[model samples]
Target: MNSEEEFFDAETGLESDDSCEVSFKDATQENGVWERRKKLPAEMISRNNFSVWNILKKCIGMELSKIAMPVVFNEPLSFLQRISEYMEHTHLIHKACSLSDSIDRMQVVAAFAVSAVASQWERTGKPFNPLLGETYELTREDEGYRLISEQVSHHPPISAFHAESLKKEFEFHGSIYPKLKFWGKSVEAEPKGTMTLELLKHKEAYTWTNPMCCVHNIILGKLWIEQYGTVEIVNHRTGDKCVLNFKPCGMFGKELHKVEGHIQDKSKKKRRVMYGKWTECMYSVDPKVYEAYKKSEKKSGGESKKLRQERSCEAEEADEMPEVQETVTVIPGSALLWRITSRPAHSAQMYNFTSFAITLNELEPGMERLLSPTDCRLRPDIRAMESGDIDLASSEKERLEEKQRAARRERSKDEEEWSTRWFQMGTNPHTGAEDWLYTGGYFDRNFTDCPNIY
Candidate 1:
């Protein structure tokens, strides 16, 4: 098989053998009415004919967002819709909100943070960048939450989102400006933004930033992705903290998908040790057990190193990669913190989207009448792509981009500033950093002042 075909086979695999037993429910409430689509109109088009290296050859070491990528490289969803995926595991936030122990609350919050990125696994396709003034709203009465997101800036491409529970239990909001760079063999995304979650019941606020994610082997060999960095989540009210280390895939791939961390109390005393694979599940155990496990692991590593030295020549010549352990080896007393929700049976053919994600772009009959003029659901390009019209999608995407550019030039000539509708740039009360705070009034359904970006 060709490299691209081989990559697809490795990435998507076969249709699930248990498809017959899998639930295909797409039930989500809208306006107290239940209706949703379980699948996109068509399966994702194959990438076998495209050569990424040809497009990225001269763009190495540059910010990728500045380059114009083809629509084929993108899934049907916009970046605003992608941001909404963060809410898929909102139950973790509710769990954290209900806990009385500060340390216990911190553990659940940490799991929620990790779970936020779990949807990206094997999802190599990018989301379409939102036009300036574009917006997306997701309301799930069943989940007791509603989210509103907007493309606040276009030049640096900032996307700001706010989500709150109907019962006023918690508030989650953030403004992200990811810096994407192409490094010849890989593409790296540094999510440069602060994410804040507030538990209204406890009056506690937590803040943290996402880790750097890298897609490797872009030019050759099998493609893979890894997240690597230190993420520090702090509770402002309780002075508690959780530090997680997303390990990079080393030469032997032994550390692939591993996440390890600890939760500390106000006094800097370690309260619990957490470890797991971010792709599957997370577990928290007593600090003493973690330390004993580490000691035993270190001794085993010492023995492996000696054996490696004896066969150093053979190892250097070996082309095979080590098999990654799929499941986390839980200690006897470890408590389950969080586990990923399974994707739909058709996920492999449908952009690798989770069940929650499959509903993000579903535009039910008459739904557009309720959305703002600038909502992403009205974007013709995305709609065309979703309907499996590749040529129309490509043409519409180009036209929309040109329209955006023309509008920018017109505003520049008139010396006018673009005004955001739902969110405004302001100082975050908790972090004291400049952020896009939701100005409310979005749910009031006044579309008179909304932009005509679509």
Candidate 2:
């Protein structure tokens, strides 16, 4: 099938059932990979050129910000929803929580944190700025996890999110404040914030901060993004921490996506070393005592040929396929050496997104009853964009924006301040900053008025 068929199925519509899940692989099947399509419109390309040239002339030695860019350079999702991108590898987190070793859990958490930056690999298109009080929630029944995010502030643009996994006894909450800068040729977004994760079973709490985001090749070449800086994950309970340094791309294309870090004990003694590419997999390896471990399987070579018929009869009795074969390799060794699976390469890119990028803003299948009236899922314009109706999306976006402006004007007349429904204000002990905490009893507290079985 072609690209059009890969994105939409004529029989089942956009929402594919299990039988007809849309695959974005090339039809020829020679190379099973995701086919890249043109991401920008011709008009937008020309508009970007003009905008870049004008900005370069005006800001000769100054840094630029979001105010310098045109709205056309934006994706259809809101920034508040973008925070959910961290959940793409929830399977890893679940597996980690199930493990018994603390070091094993730390490795998995490190992998999850590093892999979260992979979503920014392609072009750096801005997501829409969420209006004040806009909310989004994600519920994964199979994973036994739920997450809720809200936009708390509009002027300085703050967002907060909370996620919990009751089965794993894991809970996390955090806030993000993206500080954007424009340097004529590229833009930098520093997501300054702190996240706290709790393992209730272990009574352990971990905190970490994000790295700096840089978008390059915006002026004269193909645009792409890179994240540079250090990510430090610290266990407040045990004083163990992991520090990862994301190396920036060099000038002549050297070591573009390389990252190396080490896990340290309370006294800063190195324990396990990590090395990998952000776009690929991260591995924990200790080179000081490096040894390869491989498992072997043995089959009886003296078995009689007549016994094959008997085995087939037994297989038939068990409803097993005679032609199919199963091979299990169990390699039991040190748990430090393992790879974190990156996003699937064959997965389709909607508007030049990584495979897991769109999953962040995905609406739960039956969450309509649990959503508030101001939820992002109810926004008609964004929904239009999701369905590939660009014209309708643009019109609806303009209409909604104008309506928002009118509402703001009315609020100004009444001297009213926008208030969030689910989140309450609290102080962050680490930073002493007023933070928004989720008080909606989203996970444990009863929702007596909720019509949905959430």
Candidate 3:
């Protein structure tokens, strides 16, 4: 089942890696990655004519069911209004398949080609893609964000590093990122650089990767937070706005990701006493205690045992405590920008991104939009050994061979199943008669007894 133990022809695959990039400007073809852009009738808009803004307006009532939102929206556009818009863009995606002209197909397909080029627009608004169940929340801080940082010791968790490196590789070789208007103005800059392999040996891979969408990173003094934090709104998950009064603390909960503030805790409730962390983490500490430690550290002398005991019980550890987070309000425009990718390479293997660009003037009144979201951040991961390939060990090579054999067998079995059905059943009444038999019927009807059928 897990063929990771098998050896991969890294050199052959990486060195001879035939990868191409296209853009809305120029496109080429692959195994149907891009199809012709059909000449639609007078009243309709081609998918290309739809900008990010117009598309969002279109998804208002379309039923997504269980689609992968992140893959479709490369970045998170979390707002309901935006989600509805993007959905409309996809409504006509089937048009690409309908076209018959080569140029039209190229134009359609070219829209999907990645040109070592990237564009970034930094806005602190929840940019969510319903297609992919990934979200980005921009907040002042992400204290218990799974992990804030890591070190590379003897064999450190190279987890975050790999994904970051992939992003760098793409930036080095990809397209020029332009500045976003609302994000500010752009300064002159150099075009992106080219990437080439250079280094090393044994490789360890993980089946799971970073979340479908990237979360925003927090800095102590930065004015805007990108992906996760607290915010105001109807809890999209449960639809509760935290307006009901419960026990003391009058029904409080966490903040909305991307937007800042506890979406549930309103300033109007009957002066409810609130203290503690937003999450009911088993080992959560009170924020009061956390502050006490800082206070104690600044004191002139050593702490007494009684004082130490008191310090341990302080509620500084929990931020939700009314004392620490006094202004429980969200200053909108602080959410992550999740972009939508029209067509995904593989439905299951989808990629979505949340991005931000850090600069001195970004949050300033007269902002500089120079650092586009793609420039400041993008989760493009291209993995290949710098030296081209790693040699496979004997066991690994054998394992690879075994895996290939198993795959071949499975494919053959599928072919056999299809072949058997072809000879047993017959054709369609809707279309002209054909030789192929439709196998879908056997599962539902008793064909042996039915006298009248299509």
Candidate 4:
């Protein structure tokens, strides 16, 4: 058999034996948005170069074509309908709900992403559509009521894939190899999440109405792992340091990073050394600790001799008989697993987002205390200078305001462009509900009638 035959059995149009039922739920919130006003320092104000609303344009929903940077589509309804019909797991929902309530440092980071996105809408009258609708409390915003769309689109528990991705990225980013392993997507494993955060002493802790844990540079994914998932972070530095407190999204743990202590000057140059150095060091695990972690995989057959013998023989024969191996391979797909692509419905650059970047911003006395003298905060905010200090500050301030107005204008233009495309699809907001009014990044830049996952 060839790749076509093994991965896609076009002849039978049959799906794999391993499949799960998916469902969606509206998060248990009335409006799926937080109600509040953010107050910035009188002198220093911060604005976004990129709107959080834009992140929605990029990631409003998931699509099958997202696998390729440039995607192709076939069987529109069959494809998306299948994507919507993910596996139904009560345990997953429970865990998701549980995780969404975590208040850990990592959880705060996720919340900040939501808050940041929501802020953009409030600031610019744009919309913040959510994959999962959740709320801090009862409140309404100017744009409209945000919905959590608790429609849990279930697929295979992607923890192993996620962990593997993280491991690979961590090694690459840290330049140190740990015991990285990518667990194949597993059916038996329940997908759940928790958070652990170690705030370096020098990093700024933004004190909002609710203190939030700010994580810079990385895409802060859903808090508590898609509402009920697992994220483990082992702090090899600070034995016990809790630097943040915020609204509960789920349960979390705390530890400090090892690089914080070696700093002499609390300057950007010094912090840079620590951040770049230790994150690369591979934290070792004790033999006992490593063994205990294998419990999750213990049930998949307990490493039986018979299984090993069969696997060894199969490998031996595979070298000599390629066709036999091909015949034995399982085709992985679903009758529902088709693809969807489209012309550019949104702005060209706004449609496809590589990922969401979130950071906490402090209002007053901004950078003065953001990087504490004792804290070894990495990546201290770099303020670009335009001229001599005073003249530069005044000119830059005016320039920032002008850029903001221009951004608002650009957003309006993008909306108009998208609206033209939406009308082309014959979708009417005022019209009564229709059967399949699925519009997302899929029809936008996601598919672009090209590859996916760019």
Model 4, 44-145: lDDT tens digits are: 222223233323234323332222110110111111111111111111211222232222222223222122212111011111111111111000111111
| RMSD of every prediction | 8.2, 15.7, 26.5, 25.9
lDDT scores for all predictions? 0.83, 0.61, 0.20, 0.19
lDDT of 4 at 174: 7
Which prediction has the highest lDDT against the true structure?
1
Cα deviation of 327, candidate 2, in Å: 26
Give Cα distance to truth, residue 288, candidate 1, Å.
1.0
In candidate 1, which residue ranges exceed 4 Å CA deviation? 1-35, 299-322
Q: What is the TM-score of each candidate against the true structure?
A: 0.89, 0.72, 0.16, 0.17
The CA lDDT at 174 in model 1 is 98
Per-residue alpha-carbon lDDT of candidate 1 for residues 34-118, written as tens digits (9 for 90 to 100)? 5556678899987778888889999989998889988898999999999998888888898888899889999999999998999
Q: What is the lDDT of residue 84 in candidate 4?
A: 17
**True-structure lDDT of candidate 1:** 0.83
lDDT of 3 at 275: 19
